[model samples]
Target chain A: MTFLRDTATIFSREFAPVWRDPLSLVFTMAQPLLFLYLFGPLLENGTDTPGPAWQWFVPGILIMMCLSGPLMAGYFLLLDLIGGSMERLLVTPVSRTALLVGRTLKEFVVLLAQAVLIIGLAVPLGLDPHVPGVLTGLTLLVVFGIGLGGLSFVLAIVSAPGGELFYGVTQVVMFPLLLLSGVLLPVENGPGWLQVAAAVNPVTYVVEAERALFAGRFLDAPVLWGAAAAVVTALLGLHLARRRMARGL
Target chain B: MIHARGLTKTYTLKKTSVDAVRGVDLDVEPGQLVAFLGPNGAGKSTCLRMLTGLLPPTSGTARVAGHDVTTEAAAVRARIGYIGQKGGAGEAFRIGDELVTQGRCYGMTRRAARSRAEELLTVVGLDGMFARKPSTLSGGQRRRLDIALGLMNRPPLLFLDEPSTGLDPASRADIWSHILRLRADHGTTLFLTTHYLEEADAMAERVVVIDQGRIIADGTARRLKADLAGDRLTVTLHDPADVPRAAEIAAGLPGAAGLASDGPRLTLRVAAADRALPEFVRALDAAGLKIDTAESSRPTLDDVFLALTGRTIQDEEA
Candidate 1:
């Protein structure tokens, strides 16, 4: 019970800045909105997929937001570590797991709100609604986000006091993960090696699951694979992040 | 309220290992304000971190506020407040919100934390500035906010690392007054590290000096100065030829050491320059060596540091 309370405290503190500056929250969603309107239409007639572009493209955009949003969450942790705010918190009796969990909770909340806005906007653009499926897809997205955010925090701790490593690693790894996951374009037409690489990429399974769930397919193999990937990522990320927090930054 | 034995910390970075703190033992009674004095990179912050349970010791043990720092870190944390060297408030968060959050971290409920935040804001002279971001505050105001955050838990022990390092003199004095007031009001034990020698000498009840990962001196400032760096008495001779004779006469004086001569001037260290000066003067007169002028000066903490390590704290700071 104390852990939950501490997690809530941390979550509220982490979310306070965004709450005060609503404009910054909008700015965070701007890139996804841009992809939804501009690059989204490019897939309308160009792709061989059997559904309206909105159905196929909206879930991919949500996954994209999930990837970018949580992958960059560590930057704030890096700032706290560099500035001494994190150290101050560490000295307090707040549960260490709460510290990581609270920040990831903030990420989950932010991703949820963004996913809602993106889905709502896509509804008027000929996208059919699958209420339960969309809800589950959002759940999967948040689960994956929690994991990614945890990894980002782990990176932040490792790169602390000087955050150059955080920036360098994130920049180098983000695009490959996004691209190989087939978030923007399908890897089906690519060579066998590329498909194999995408097959191994956990993000690819998540994207496939998002597409399947959004199309109202509940029992697809992709859903199981994506759910497994997200759960595993979340468990690994939380374990590593909590261990790092416990060990001290 | 704090006790440690053989507390040590070593950092193994890549191939080279650095012993940041080696075999530190310390004890602090409740309500004692101890100023930890050391140069930069002297392991002052490292030792503080270990004591606060922020960093685990590589070996040894510390019990702060009745809990072992290693195994019972949370209990220790709950009973103490630590103000780090940097601004503790996040730049983006409101000062009041940060303080309240600190209170909440210690398990204070929302209503209680809010009231405590209001009270501490007034204590730190930051009343009505709850909405102000830390980035907008002046250096001194930011420091006060840090203090308010540290006090939110109302812990019996508070550790401040360089609490006034970058503040102006006026601000530094302001900080000291606040610290002294807090101690008086709550009898909170304060263990703070500081780079300013005068602040430590003027404010702290006891002083602990560390150098190169080892504690070299520990005592009251007065005692350390008197024992390690005695007062200096200098005399100007009527003739340069009399200086060598004056030096010999000065060495003969009881409790005199570090006798030196330069041209017509002579100087020596004595436990009390006031008592030794007149005796040395009479001896020089008996030898028929006249003195032009005599003066005595009391030693500062710097002098004590110099006597212990042969390097002034100011020189190390530079």
Candidate 2:
């Protein structure tokens, strides 16, 4: 009960300010738009047939949106820690489990919101985001974002940088995940070793399964791997982040 | 309440191992406010961290509010409020919601958490800053808010680490006032560590002075000062050359720890001036060295600490 309470409190308190800041709000909306415009038609128009290309690009964009939400949340974790804010929080009756769960869930909630906004916008761009199926797929994406964000928080916590180095780490975590997710191009077309690398990339399943959902195409292979990826990543992030926070290092 | 026996911690840094808190034993009732005073690197912070269960001791056991901090840290945390040396609010959230989140984290319902936050903000003198962001607060204000957050659960014990480090004089007084009143209002035990000698002397009922990972002295400020050192006497002679004669004269007095020439003045440590001053002055007149002026004052905690440890409290930090 205390865990849920703490987590929810952290979620609401943390997400509220980001929601209010106009600049952050504009950037959040603009991020996916920039990605869609920059990566979308460039890859699609470059291809012989742009129709299927847009279809593929839509899922990729949505996953990227989901991925960015959690990755950015790590920045907050790092700020709290280095500023001595997180240390102050520990002085209270708050359980470390609650602190970890609350902070991680807050990031997940934002990523979920971003996923919804992007997935909703994807429909008119020559792509079919089957509402219910895409919602479920993005829900999985939100879960994935939570896990990734948790990992990000732990990284931010562990890195514990002072100033400009913080934003540097944020971009480092974010850009790599976006590139590796195979959001814009087919995984097989990349380098052979990169193809082998993509097999184990949970983010690969995220884009493929989400793209399949957005295109309204039911694949022969089930999306169990993507769902598992979402759960495993989220839990792993939660477990490790919780342990780290508890140690109060 | 807290009871600790043989509480010890050793931190092995990259190359060297530091025994932060070698061995300590202490007892506190449910509502006592005991101040721990030490200079920089004196291990006061390390001991508080271990006592609060933030850091595990390398050896020994501690019970906070009757719960073992090692085996039942969850319960120990649940029962105490901790305000660390650094204010720990992250960049996200309004001050109000941060307090609410803290309340909820300790098991308050949403409505209860909100109400409790409102009450605590007022108590901590942050009533008007509810909607304001934490990033907007000044250092002292942020610390007060941090205190409010620590009190969210109304824990039985509160561990405050350097609560007055960077505050202005007025702000420090304001905080000390609140700390003194907390026990009366909430019956909360406060274990505070501070580098300010005056803060510990003026506020705490009992003081513990630690130096280099060991307990150098522990007692009420009065006893520590009175038992360890005598009152200091500063005397000025009419002529500078008369200092040596005055020193030789004062040395014969009962309980007088020989006089020393301090620049143009002579100073001595006397166990009891009331009993020895007259005889010492008679001897001084016999030596034909006139005592121009003399003054005696009780020793302070700083003197006691310096006397016992062979070094002043702020000396290490400097």
Candidate 3:
């Protein structure tokens, strides 16, 4: 009873800060759009600077979105942590797991909006959204958002100043992940070590999945790998965050 | 219901895990107001956190409401309401919403939550600010809301970490007044920690004093004070800065058995000051020290603390 009640209560209430803060939404969406509009095209259809622009670069862009999603979650969670908001929640008969689940569920709304904006921009840049392409893209975004939300919850725990020092650490960790995910260019041509890191990067799966979506078909290793990655990362992240929440994080 | 036996907490901060709470045993009954008195970082907060299941114990065990703190936390959580030293409610929502959600987490229906919220808002004297965000409320109002949030489920056991820390005198009075009302009305078991000794003296039924990770004394305030009778005296030293010198000056006197410094004031052991006063003064003059002002007075809780811990709580706080 506490778990069900707490999940509903936490989800409904916690979502407000994200929705109500106009600045949070504007700032979160702004930079991603600037890159989409200004730089997204620079890599389009063999600009002669390097290899296949859309083939390699698109996945990285999508992966970057996934990896960075939890950074947003980390920011809000840490405030609540230091502010004693999360500790108060722990005192309740609230469900430990529900705290993060509710958060991930709420972010589905933001994920949908991000997907629409991305697709809207993608169309102007001449990426055709065939029926299957659009459907697969939407599915991937759902998985991506949930996965990111869970990771952010985990990051938020470690980010707790008393525990993990999340702000400085996350900021630094986020950048290299973006570069290695190959959001700006292909990491395939980078050094062997960087190539390995990119390959192992969960965002790479997102990029690969997005590539499949853009091709008007979704199948093979990439889509399965992406979905699997999201599922595993979410479970792991939720597990860690729940431990912290349970132990009074 | 709470029982802790040899409870200890050691926190590992990268290089070292210092023991914050060490070998403490306590037993508390339901609906009693027990005050945890200590200086800052004297393990009061650490012990309270463990009792409420907020921090894991480094060693030993505690049971609250029949649930083991480490193994049965969710059950312990269900049976208790814990308001920490800092205001800990969700700040993004309206106060009414926050209280309602708290109620619902205890398995109450929406209508039930609303009725309960209404009752509590009125109880904490926050009726008009139901619709305002907690982030927008004044400090006193935020603290009131913190109490309301802790009480939403009508928890059988309540833990308040410094229930009064920062507030104007008026607000402190108002908050404590509300707290007394809640205790009378609900008979809720209460445990609170505070650095304010007077607050403890004024409100607490029993006082447990801890210092340097150990329980120095535990008894009713009256009993602790009674233990200090016939031996303590308040006297002035000629100079505040020369307290050490004054201590030696008082110590050499024949009947001055126990002597201690409390800032400019010196307290010494004497069975009857009237019999020993002339000789003590003559010895001070012989020692070439004039009394600025001196009186042998009845013992206070401050003296009680000093007698038990060998250091006053004020010095520990400093």
For A7-83, candidate 2 gives per-residue lDDT tens digits of 66666767677667735655766878887766676665565432477777877777777776666677777777777
Candidate 1, residue A177: how far the Cα is off, in Å: 1.0
Looking at model 2, residue A146 earns an lDDT score of 72
- Output the better candidate (1/2) by lDDT: 1
DockQ for each model: 0.89, 0.59, 0.56
List where candidate 1 sits over 4 angstroms from the true fold. Answer: A48-50
lDDT of 3 by residue, A126-205 (tens): 65655677667667766666656666777667766564567667777778767776678767667999999988888777
If candidate 2 were superposed on the true structure by all CA atoms, what would the RMSD be?
A: 3.3
Task: Identify the leading candidate in terms of lDDT.
Answer: 1
iRMSD for each candidate structure, in the order shown = 0.7, 2.1, 1.8
lDDT of 1 by residue, A1-249 (tens): 999999999999999988988778779899899998888778888755556777877888898899888866788888899998999999999988888889888888888988998998988877896999999999999898988998999998899888899989999988888889888878887899999999999999999999999988999999999999999999998888888876777
TM-score of 1: 0.97
lDDT of 1 at B178: 94
TM-scores of chain A across candidates = 0.96, 0.85, 0.83
Q: TM-score of chain A, model 1?
A: 0.96
Runs in model 2 with CA error above 4 Å? A18-26, A48-51, A131-133, A161-169, A185-202, A217-232, B88-91, B184-187, B239-245, B262-264, B272-279
Q: What's the alpha carbon RMSD for model 3?
A: 5.5
